[model samples]
Target: YGPRTERSKLPRVKVAEPATPEQIQETRRARAKAKTETPTLKIEHKVPAAERRCTVCGRTDLTTIGSGKSSFVNEYVSSQLVREEHVQEVLRCPCGSCVITAPGAPKVVGKGQYGASFLAHLAVAKCADHLPIYRIEKELARKGSPVARSTMNELLHRCATIVEPISKRLLDLICTRDVVLADETRLPMRNVPKGKSKTGFVWTFGAPDELGGVDIAYQFANSRSGATPRKLLEGTSGILLVDGYSGYNDIEKVSSRRRAACYAHVRRYFFDSLKTAPIAQEALDLVTALYRVEHEAKEARFDESSHL
Candidate 1:
């Protein structure tokens, strides 16, 4: 009875409504701004002559006024695979001494049926969109252009070969930057020995726009050993921000590279320990507060001294 009476006396906190007035006003302004900022092609619709007659007055003639009410509608255009045929012409002089022929059209894969635009779309679909080659084959079949999976794979390989030089240039540029973010993740290699799969690592290196926007480079290696990144970053001298992976220790020790631990990784450890250790919750809370302060500083575009 005592516990029940105490529980009853405890204060009941009510949950407030989801949105405040300021938030509602901000939402309205955001919608209006989106409408104004979005690029739109205005298409005017006119009333047909048959429907333009007035039903009440039985008048056959009608004219449009200053302006009509406007409404916006979203639309979509489906992607399609197009086929193009190029014809080369040959010419012969009247003397029959010489013959001239126009040069053949350029191809992504030399002497191959695919064009540069087709190869570009195929590469973007497979690499950037993460679409499987088998699925792309199915999609192409549905579009009345059935390209075999093996053929697509060959084309993709050829495209990679074509762009290898550009990729190398990007890597060189990234290595020259003063600061880089590095990480690695496991990738599975299919059809390994004994009909099994093998684990591979993809090492990613990135530099932001402030660091000259070198873009990101991905290097795949069979092993997650320290030597992989050490070799890739051989001549690079800069600060590397990475998670606490002992693989990077050798790079830091041997090269002119400074290693900085990722704060998000530290916070992740505290977050995982919260269930077992109550003190970890306090650390997590502090980290969350720090993130909030950082967010506010970024939103306000505060400089280093101002943030401090």
Candidate 2:
């Protein structure tokens, strides 16, 4: 379906109930299982006992077919979120002196209605997957966790507020690395003034060799200025890889940072000149040869630190 026009009411996700003693014991005894690399969800449809009969002359007798044939086709499974409702106990003195309520689960956002898992799912779907909020809203409605798009957006903003410190810490750590690549892209602001649209830039800095699954920090600005990148490259005494952007010149001037130009940008100039000038073909050929050597080296498991 196309974009939804009507403001539909969203249904709340199913609340989790308190587990029984037996169920709790069973859950505690459960062990972690290794996951399959290939497709694991194989839904096999079996013939019912009442219908498992010979097709010839309505005969009821049939021999075992030894695990009948199965055809596999990819299918979609909708994800539904469940809410964990914690029912805390309340204690009061007989003399009505004081009352106390038991503590609940840790909050991702203080006193937040949604759980951390729900907030994480929404953040990944929107930020990582670039899924539209309306589509996410519709998906939730289709699955049983029907949450309003507005509510989801609000929760995401709150989640961001909670994660802001973590992101800053990651970015600070990345900046301290000896090598970092930085790039920027234009972003269209949706909730800007209605008369005219406003544009912002999203800058990302990554230290390619940095591990431990932490991401590079990003900075967002309304204007594309050298200050935005200078701030990101602050205290970066190592090499900085970037595209053909003069904004980073200030970074090289102020700091003892080794600025490395991207080969993709260098090749693009020759690539565009190929149509107008024939001499550019030789440069393109050399670039292609260089890329082939790099590819070969990668196939041979060669890294920057690898010798020979």
Candidate 3:
């Protein structure tokens, strides 16, 4: 009776209503921006000289006027390949003392038959768009420029060789950042042995970019070894954010390099303990708040703004 009276003496309190699932989802969604259908690459269809004349009277002479009708077309233009022949002229001195020749066309891959633009298209098709080499060969053949599959394979290899220095520079820049995120994922190599299988891993290092993304550089290795990361991160002095992988443990050996916790990995532990401990909910809530803050900052374009 005393306990009931004490409970009744307490003031009445009300709890705020939890947001509906629909409202929560609405808050999390990113609204699409209104699109302006303006195209940068526009091809104008000019009237031919023969058709420029008056159609009804067939008059030869006519004053230039505005267009009779106009309409816009949304189109997908297939890329085409063109053969380029550079003609260099040689000039001889009047006294027959010396000869001079015009500079030849630039070599993208040491006198390679294909131009840089063509090679770039192939690289983007393979790496960015994930198109198979055989598919690319067929597409080009349909477009009237049939290239051999082996030739494309060699061209892609040469392109990778040409960009080796750029890859190193990108890694260097990533290392210069105060905080770097690193991870590795398994992928199968197509060049494995005929009978036995081989597993490959692509380790990626990431740095924050102005476009609200993590600018990443990656390397392919056959094994998930600490030595790989040690070699890749040589001369690096910064904190690394990565999953609790044993391969990254070598980074702790270096006095200059330190390891930081990955929030996603940490959150998983708390989430798994939700059934056992109620206090884990608080930790999960904090992580959710952190993610919300990051989303809001991204929406505000805070990353695009410069500090210096």
Candidate 4:
């Protein structure tokens, strides 16, 4: 294992003729199961409505008085966003200090619509549903409230500005956490300063800490280079779980910093192999071993805290 010696190419072994019908059926079933078996976020229970009561006074009495539902119909876009409109006025004040008024719907985007709730729905639509403002405006016009696309864009920027402080705080907590998972995904952003039409990269850092569980931070950079991760993780010391990218190697340059390879990345190679060269069963088996280890670890509920 010192100096690698080149090996002579072995004669390619012919795989038995293409799988039979039965074998193909079995492969189909296994692939379907493997695709469906990927782990996902598990939310156990919803927080009780009673739990939202005021902490100062034990008043479990709260009721919604006026409620209305609005339908925003757009014939142009093949999407319909139906939302409930609510007007709730709380009856009791725990300490008699303030009367809590929670509006039913948002009216910010649409003139006749609910303000905060509307803004919130629009924000969620933009962020989660990935809908552009012009489309949303057209959708709103069908419902009677005509919202301008430019206004929607400004609203989003305002919302982002409002939440940026919270994002910075959470990001700070994440970067200072015990262990962090670092990765980057491509983001399409205009780099006008560089006078180029190329897209920017969004460096993502997911860190877990006892204080705030997991915090995800994203930064848009002009390029995907080692310097980005190096700068983000500079002066940080922890095990970084990342895809085996050379960019992460720069972390080791900082004394005492460690890196762990993502099993998902290793599994992806097997998937690619299955698609490109299905006959490479030996390589497939090696990848399968990696999945087996991950499965066993998950079943054991392996606590990464031990490494702390």
Candidate 5:
């Protein structure tokens, strides 16, 4: 036999109703704010005089009315590489004894040809979009600016060096928070030996505020050892919400932080045990009830004290 198969009914999920008039207007205002938040160069289009005339009456006279109807159209401007020529005007005294020149243009890297904007774009493409250097080079070539892959790699390293301080500052800010959540995931790294790879762990730390805003930081380590969390969260004291990992326990013992186990992990263990242990089903039912209560509290906008 290949395998056992069974058919069952799927659970139904509730669909949200359409927004009220007030909610719709609020959404429109928020969208307008988002649309205008960016710095944009606007180009206005005006109706030609001939086209503005009344077509049915064939009259050129038109009455000015209230502000004309308006709509917003989003457009993407393609990236183009431009050669910026900086001309510094040289000034000299009539006696020719002293001379001065305009200041030179600033660059992302000292004496480097690439501008700060270009370097920032490259960095965002590589890090945020996960584009390889070779792929980025091909894209630049298609845009009429063919740059060497090696040169792009060097520039990326230089950009990373410039951004390191800002990243450290963000990490420091996250550490100062009262509550933090952490997790780790495995990442494969190419090893020195040909056709070989090493498994590494990428630990993530997140600090979430009451307003649903979050700041996250990541640390990459070769091994998922207890010392990794200890080093990454050094000097940080708070409530850590994480899965039941032994490594975190070691950190909790050494630091002032307290470890709070994830309820989802407990639910998962009970769910898995249902296969062999029938009593696990009762635990699952209790967990479901707890979640339902939590959902009701959220829907009613209950605060911590109100829920208590």
Candidate 6:
């Protein structure tokens, strides 16, 4: 009876209703003050002007000499070039004997509408920014450029061709490297015809050899067959850090091989199976323990630098 009386004596509290006008105005002012207290960020882009001038005497004086068929007096000079806005102009000299010619402006991309810097921006936007070409074309139109998607495609193709030499050299470096990591990811080639789901594969190889720095190579292929690894890594040797993909097994000829699997991949499979598989929780616990070990290793300088 005493416990029941004490429980009944306890008071109940109610939740507050909507704020009054004064409180609302105060809240709005507080928010405005917070916004004013924060700093604003601004971005700027600058493009350098293109110009040409004389190397010697630093004078703009120039003259054109051409190979007008020379019998003995009136001669045409082959050195004469068609004038354009890109071509530099100089003050004409009376005598055609000595002509100080300014070399034509260097082109980032030759003949094509897009410049070198523009191609670079486009590549970064596509690869890093994950923007599709169609979106980029729309953006260009918004900026008054009105660039076509086909033009963008041509630009990308030309850029890829131009950089192929560097890419090949990097691939060669990767091939020579004793330590390497190789993997492939699927890319949907949507341009292909219907019912043909053309699944393209992107092969990435990385790490360095006796030469110097790390080199990465990416190749696109129509197939992701086991033989794909064999084709890309022919005559390659040493440690190949990769995911648990059976396709890599076709390249067993790799010398002094050591396989290090991605722990994240193993964790992902166990996590996905956790709902149905009773043993999945146990596997997850083991993976969590491994991750804790990795975390501890990262925090504490446990291993010697050479062993690391």
- Considering every candidate listed, which one attains the maximal lDDT? 5
Writing each residue's lDDT as its tens digit, candidate 1 over 117-227 gives 888999999999999999999998998889999999999999899899998787767766778888898888785567988888988888765633348988788889988
Candidate no. 4 TM-score: 0.54
Local distance difference test, per candidate? 0.78, 0.77, 0.78, 0.68, 0.79, 0.68
lDDT of 6 by residue, 147-258 (tens): 7898888888888889899988888777666677888888876755575656688888888644454677887777887666676667766777889988887566654466
Name the candidate, 5 or 6, with the larger lDDT value: 5
TM-score for candidate 6, residues paired by index: 0.60
Clashing pairs in 4: 86-104, 106-114, 106-115, 106-117, 106-118, 107-113, 107-114, 107-115, 108-115
My TM-score estimates for the predictions, one after another, are 0.76, 0.71, 0.72, 0.54, 0.77, 0.60
Candidate no. 1 TM-score: 0.76
Q: How many residue pairs clash in each candidate?
A: 0, 0, 0, 9, 0, 7
Model 5 CA deviation exceeding 4 Å by range: 1-25, 36-41, 46-69, 193-195, 209-212, 278-282, 285-308
lDDT of 4 by residue, 99-194 (tens): 867665545344544356666888899988999788889888997668788878888887788788988787777766668888877777655799
Instruction: For model 2, state the Cα shift of residue 118 in Å.
Output: 0.6
Model 6 Cα displacement at 38 (Å)?
19
Q: Per-residue CA lDDT of candidate 3, range 1-308, in tens?
A: 12321111111223224666875665556341112334546456767887887879989787756755555565776789999889999999999999999999998977778999999999999999999999999999999999999999999999999999999899878877877889898887666467666788988989886556777898888888877788877667878899999888888675377889899889788777877986777777777767666765554446556431
lDDT of 2 by residue, 191-280 (tens): 556766788899988886434343577889888998987876766699988997988888987677999999878977877776788677
Which is the better candidate, 3 or 6, if ranked by lDDT? 3
Tens-digit lDDT track for model 5 on 172-219?
A: 777668888889888888998787999999888889756667998887
Q: What is the alpha-carbon lDDT for the whole of candidate 5?
A: 0.79
User: In model 6, how large is the Cα lDDT of residue 63?
Assistant: 48
- On TM-score, the candidate that comes out on top is 5
Write down the lDDT that model 3 would get.
0.78
Off by over 4 Å in 6: 1-87, 97-100, 191-196, 208-215, 254-256, 268-282, 293-308
Please give the RMSD of candidate 5 to the true structure. Answer: 5.1
